[model samples]
Target: MLDREPYADLPDLPRFDLTSEDVTDGGPLARAQLSGIMGAGGDDVSPQLSWSGAPEGTKSYVVTVFDPDAPTPSGFWHWCLSNIPAGVTSLERGAASDPPAGAVRHRNDGGTDEYIGAAPPPGHGTHRYIVCVTAVDVEELEVGPDDSPATVNFQLFFHGLGRALLTGTHEEQ
Candidate 1:
């Protein structure tokens, strides 16, 4: 069986937190003032991200947004990206969809290589978007650029050095 804990063999790395000015509790997303929406403003509004305390020997980073409570058995991927340089610490809003220089955007669950903002079913209550930034040991994985999110995650199993997670909630009326 595949190891469920990919990081089980790696040494413990420092942890970091991700926060945003455009995210808040029970407020209008527009007022949180983040960029990018599924059908709005080019759909490239990446969230602002900042982090600290990456582990030693980290060569690069990968960012992803996952929703475990989606109506599918495999959940959903809102965004997936890899090959972010270690020197970079933040991404402008919509940057996840329109990655910066040298980064690669993987296909989300919708089968498109972009960020699809939360639009949970009318009665699904609230859904959480788990945004994660993984510190990696390599600049790039063995997987190809056209790989799906599952493929990219498979590669991450071996090279992940550490990770940081941030969560935001959304609900549709």
Candidate 2:
């Protein structure tokens, strides 16, 4: 297993609260959180997420799902949603299908503008999914819907005011 913390190189931003109803930190992902699109024999549903205690000046939020233990140098981005209204803190399960108004769903590594759940290769051991919420200083990032997750991350590096994260693990035979 790769010992990688995806955010290790990021600036030490203030931390906040992030919780999920369908995914538990350090626990195995539910079948709903696995990838049907990738033929993982499970529904590719995004988990329900909630957060609080963001920095005082936070104007918007960004949400991302990353797989750091992927078999590639750049890892993989499963989801990237940006420009979420600051007042909005919780996302209902399956919200990836219809993101909050004004929020932009950036392209994931799979080239889809929605959450594509875990589908690590069989026999690849376990993989960790880091679900993150970022409090941003600006109302909207410079990137557009066509932009990649890396682009959103780059903007986040500059305008992010706080961050919260939860992790879930999964594997196949």
Candidate 3:
């Protein structure tokens, strides 16, 4: 397994709260959190996530879930959601499976809008799911719904006013 940097350089910003009912920081993902491709009875679902304490200038938010240890140099993005209203601080489980009105869903590495639950190759060792919620200074970023997650990631470095992170891990035997 390769160890890769999770994110690029980000400006110093206020720390915020990011909690999950289905995932714990630095813990293994539940079977339910695994992709349906992993086994029976599983569906690709995003876990319930809640956040708070956005900076004063924040007008919107962006959420990204990435796997840095993937067998690739650029890593892999499982989910990318942009143009979220600042007032919205919580996402129900499976909410990301179908984005709500006004929310922009960018194409992840797998070329999907919905979350693709972790599926580290068998015996690839532990893979980290780094979930991030970024508070942005603008209500909407320049990136569009058809844009790639990497494009949104680039904009985040410039517009993000604050951010919070919650990481979970998964590995197949």
Candidate 4:
């Protein structure tokens, strides 16, 4: 038996499938997109992401990338976006940084409203980037455009109907 909270009162939230061609599980990120500018530091662009099989009642979508292995005990958020139209299924490179109209981009832990590529410490081994696409019941959350990732998450907790997650790992060179 699972010790997690019961969801008997909530709608049956089904799991969706998501994938990304620009990233591989337990693999290294492309050198061109590594954290730290080439010869400086940071990645050049965000990874590509795609998904399918959202629940029938899904009215919108929310995308987020999290790094649990960050130095901070609570972890770090790399990117967050909400209000993606249900018809849309994927995001191209750099989309997280400059999302299309109707979508809202929240500030990451770095205090920037853009995707921050992985930057684990020199000997932290592999760090996972949990990329998620949440099927939401609401077309748009009540959050402001300048809200932070934490605020977005609070809204998501109440609005998410289902979610799909894909994990990619990166290590310092």
* Estimated TM-score for each candidate: 0.79, 0.98, 0.93, 0.85
Give per-residue lDDT, candidate 2, residue 115: 90
In model 4, where do residues sit more than 4 Å from their true spots? 1-13, 37-42
**Stronger candidate by TM-score (2 vs 4):** 2
For model 3, give the 10-residue run with minimal summed lDDT: 33-42
Which candidate number has the best lDDT? 2
Candidate 2 C-alpha lDDT tens digits along 1-173: 57789898999999999999998999999999999999888788999999999999999999999999889998989999999999999999998989999999988888889899999999999999999999999998898999999999999999999999999999988
Clashing pairs in 4: 35-42, 36-41, 36-42, 37-41, 37-42
Assess each prediction's global lDDT (C-alpha) against the native: 0.69, 0.93, 0.85, 0.75
Per-residue accuracy of model 1 over 43-142 as CA lDDT, tens digit each: 3344677777888888888888776667776677878888888887788876865677888888887667877766556677666666778888998776
- The TM-score that candidate 4 achieves is 0.85
TM-score comparison, 3 vs 4, better candidate? 3
Q: What's the lDDT of the predicted structure labeled candidate 1?
A: 0.69
- Per-residue alpha-carbon lDDT of model 4 for 20-119, expressed as tens digits? 8887755666653456632327564778888999988888898888877777756778788888888888999899767867898888887777787777
| Runs in model 3 lying further than 4 Å from the true structure | 38-41
